[model samples]
Target: MERAVRWDRLREEMAREGVELLALVPGANLFYLTGLHFHRMERPIVALLPREGEPALILPAFEVEKAQRAPIPWRLFPYTDAEGPASAFHAAAAALGGRGHTIAVETLGMRVLEWSLLAEAFESPTPLPAEPLLARLRMVKGPEEIAAIRRAIAAAEAALQQWLPEVRPGMTEREATRRLIQACFAAGADALAFEPIVVAGPNAALPHATPSERPMGPGEMMIVDFGVIMDGYVSDLTRTFVLGEPDPETARIYEVVREANAAGRAAVRPGIPAEAVDRAARAVIEAAGYGPYFPHRTGHGLGLEIHEPPYLVQGDRTLLTPGMVFTVEPGIYLPGRGGVRIEDVVVVTETGGESLTTFPRELRSL
Candidate 1:
């Protein structure tokens, strides 16, 4: 029932919003609507869905085989190199009645060259932003999507745990990252979501730092931030640990961040505003007198992409919904000393938010 309901709801939303048609390029939104993942090449590809009719796919002749796998019912408009890629796009626009009617498009995903051809296809060329409609449809997680995310988290967690024993002193950051990624493949992950962050000592102070040749030292704080992809969905997480015995000050900061992370997760409930959840974690760090060191927002949404709407930050008025899933990460960075960041994937429920990744957050000294 949920499987059928997922696609049906999107069509209903398009009709209700008075969107005559929707044009999606190669990106998360495209994959979200139709389960098709293809490359954007010289010959472009687009999925066109009408409010009350079947979808049409326009692509180069080479893309027809892959586009056929799209979940949505579609008509193919394939063109060859002689006619150019935009030729196929023009053919699709002709089917949609010269684009005088309102057409919804994803601004971020569509390329400039495609936009130019599209703009020329229309007489008035008024493009409506499709993010609101797309976001509305994707905000709630269906049973299948939830299952994929859970599986992704499990594989990612296993990858991190498998590398724990090898995180001893004298290990290069890049070497440790390689082993961690190998564990992900061994745990059945199809691909990694992003380049994993492997930072030790002062390098840990910079969030999103790349893995380097720096060797692990005794008592140095290390951060391993990584994610895995499963069934087109993504899972993101970060854990900080010490190589040897961390100083008392480092331990205190770790505890503060852990407490802040907990506070953020606890604040997620059905009527609370997104900003309030961020404040909940921010308050904890502020109370501990480390507010200045705690930079960046508490967290962001996770699903088709690493980042999305309903962000956990100050002044985000978006209210929590039961099916919404995001991360609750809190960090404290003291320049020249080190930093700690702990993150987990969580889904908002009727009772409260349920954390998907439950790796222990206790400060660990390897």
Candidate 2:
């Protein structure tokens, strides 16, 4: 019933946007609507949802059972490898009132193969970008979604706790990353949100640095960024640590970034503009003379997709509302040295914002 309501809402939105149908490939949107996940393969699987009448799915013959388990009723158009998907696409298009229909699609998620199939199926099909409509629906998370995110956060924190004690001075970044991945799964993570990022010394200066063979040593800073996925939702976190005592400059910048992260979290509240949070955090770094080094937005929305709408960045005027979840990450990187980034996942409430990640923000020395 919940999924049906969501599909109905999407139909209403499509009607208002002058779109007669909305097509989705195998991605977050398809899972969001049908509670089914399909891998992106040579054979394309597409869902065509009309403004009225039953939704239709064109997929491989083997996936018919999976399609039948969807929460909402849908017309199935299954095809075999020998037959190809053209027949299924044509059947779906006919079910959706073929020819010259305005179809909205996720511009970023759809593949050219799917588009070509759609074009061949419908006559002079008008394509509309469905990003805005989908973004609006996904931005505000419901109770079940929030609960799943909280579970993911707890799993990630537990994994970090289990792996932190095993950190040794001579351990390579890749070794630590492997241990962390094991711990996440042991702590009940369904999967990782992304590859674990473990960088030490000069490599920490790179915001998206990959874990390398370089060994962690004393007297330098290391940044460990990771996340865990549970029940389809995900949690992202980054924490900078020191092996022993840090230099005066490194310690100062850590404090500055920590303060900036706090300010960004403090700025999250209902009705406030999303940019306000970015400005609040950026002001702290700029005041401490590290404005240029603190590049990238403060954070992004967190849910099924690691990054989504309601981003905390300058000039994004999207208002913060209750049930919206995002990250508050602020960092400062000094070239030829290291960087400090403290991130936390937070959800907006009617009164204020609540952080889901409670791992200590204080500088920890292994």
Candidate 3:
């Protein structure tokens, strides 16, 4: 019933946006709507949702049984590998009335193969970008969604708390990554959000650096960026750490990033433009003369996918609303040297923003 309400909300948004149908492939939107997981493969699995009719589930024959357990009744159009998906797509389109209708699709998530099928089935219908409509429905999370994110956060923080103390001076970044992955599962993680970004010293200069064989020694710091998946949601949290003692310059940069993260979080509130948060955080980093080193946006929306709508960056004028969740990550990465990044998840509230990530922000030595 809860999931049905989510569909109803999507339909409402669709109506408001003049969307007659939503054509989705196997991705977060499909999983979000049907609560079914389908790994991306050459074989296409599509869903056609019409505004005023029964939703159609076009998938492989083997997957039809799973749709029976879906909360909402979906008109099934199953296809066998021998039969192929063309018939299923054509049947769904004929049943849903696709010609000349305003169809919307995830321009980013849907593959060209799926798009070609959709075009042939719908007689070359030009699909509108569904992101704006989907964002309207998904950006502001409900209470249950927030709770799920909290569970993910709890597991992530618990893993960090247990793993940080075990850090030794001579372990390679790859070794450190292995131990963190084990801790996440031991601490009750359903899955990892992304590959653990365990980088030390110069390697930390890259925002999404892969773990290397470089051994972290005392007097140098490391940046550990990781998250855990739980209850169908993910948490993203980053913290910089020192082995024994930090250089004075490194310590100062860490403090600068910490303050910027706080400012970004503080700027969140109902009715403010989303870019305001970016400006608030960037102002701090720029004032300190490290603006050029801050390459990425202040943060991004977090929920179903690692990166989503209401991006915290310049020129994004989406107004902040209560229940919207995002991150406030500010970093200063020097090209040749190390970098400092402090990331925390925050949700917009009627009063202000509430941080979902509560693991300490203080710079500590391992």
Candidate 4:
């Protein structure tokens, strides 16, 4: 019922924007609204219709049984590889009286073959990118959406706690990353938010360096940036730690980034422009004489996809709303001297912002 209501909201937005119908090909948007997962292959999967009217589900004949489990009200149109998607889509759209209407399709997921098939069916029908219209609706999460994110965060934190004790000098970066990846699966997570980032020592300066064979050295920083997926929702969190007594410069940089992260989090609230969050953290780093070292936006929306709308950057003016959720990550990287970054997923609340990840952000020196 929650998903149905959310879909209704999206449909309303599409109609208001002059879109007669919204079509979803294979992707997160499809999985989100229909609770159906279809791999890209010879078989094609799609959802078609306007928000206010009944939508049709176009699936391979073998996958029709899966739609029986969907909570939304939908008509099923089954096709086979022998018949092809063009014929199936044409039949489904004709059945729904959408043959001559303008339909919006996901630009990111609609393949060239699918696009041609969809085009061949509609006469003088216009097709456009539905991402902008759909993203507007998905950016502001609802209670159920936030709950899913909270669950993902809980699972990620549990996995992190389990791996914390094992963190020490001489351990290879890949070893630690592998440990956490396994923990995520063992903790009931369906998938990883993204590839685990485990960087140590000088490599930490690289914002997204993959885990390596380099052995962690004493007094050098190690960055563990990862998230777990729960029921399709994602939670991203990052923490930098030192194996033992740390260098004074490293410690100072850590403190500066920590303060910047805090400042950014504190600035998050309903009605604040997205860029303000970036500025709040940027100010902290700039005051510490590390402005140039702070690259990348302050954060991004987190939900069905790890990265989404209302990006916290220099020129984004989207106002934060109560149900929106995102991260407040700030970092200061010094070439050859290591770097420090702390991040936490937070939800905008009626009162302020509530952090989903509760892992300690303090500079941990083991």
Predicted model with the maximum TM-score: 2
| lDDT per residue (tens digit) for residues 184-223 in model 1 | 9999999999999988998899987888999989999999
Cα error of candidate 1 at position 359, Å: 0.6
- Summarize candidate 4's per-residue lDDT along 1-366 as a digit string, tens digits: 777676778867887778887878777888877777778875767788675667888888888777888776788888777876677888876876746777888887788777676677765579877988888878988878899999999999898888889888999999989988988887878899999998888899989888899998998998889998887899899999998988788888889999998999899889889999999999999998999998889899989989888799999999999999899999988888688889999899998888888999888886
* Candidate 3 minimal-lDDT segment of 10 residues: 94-103
Candidate 4 wrongly placed segments (more than 4 Å)? 98-100
Lowest summed-lDDT stretch of 10 residues in model 2? 1-10
Please provide TM-scores, in order, for all candidate models, with all chains considered together. Answer: 0.95, 0.98, 0.97, 0.93
lDDT of each: 0.85, 0.92, 0.91, 0.85
What TM-score does candidate 2 get on C-alpha atoms? 0.98
The residue ranges of model 3 lying beyond 4 angstroms of the native Cα positions read none
- Show the lowest summed lDDT stretch of 10 residues, model 1: 1-10
TM-score of 1: 0.95
Compare candidates 1 and 2 on lDDT and give the better one: 2
Which pairs clash in model 4? none
lDDT (tens digit, per residue) of candidate 3 on 217-303: 887779999998997899999999988899999999999999999999988999999899999999999999999999999999999
Give the worst 10-residue stretch by lDDT in candidate 4.
115-124
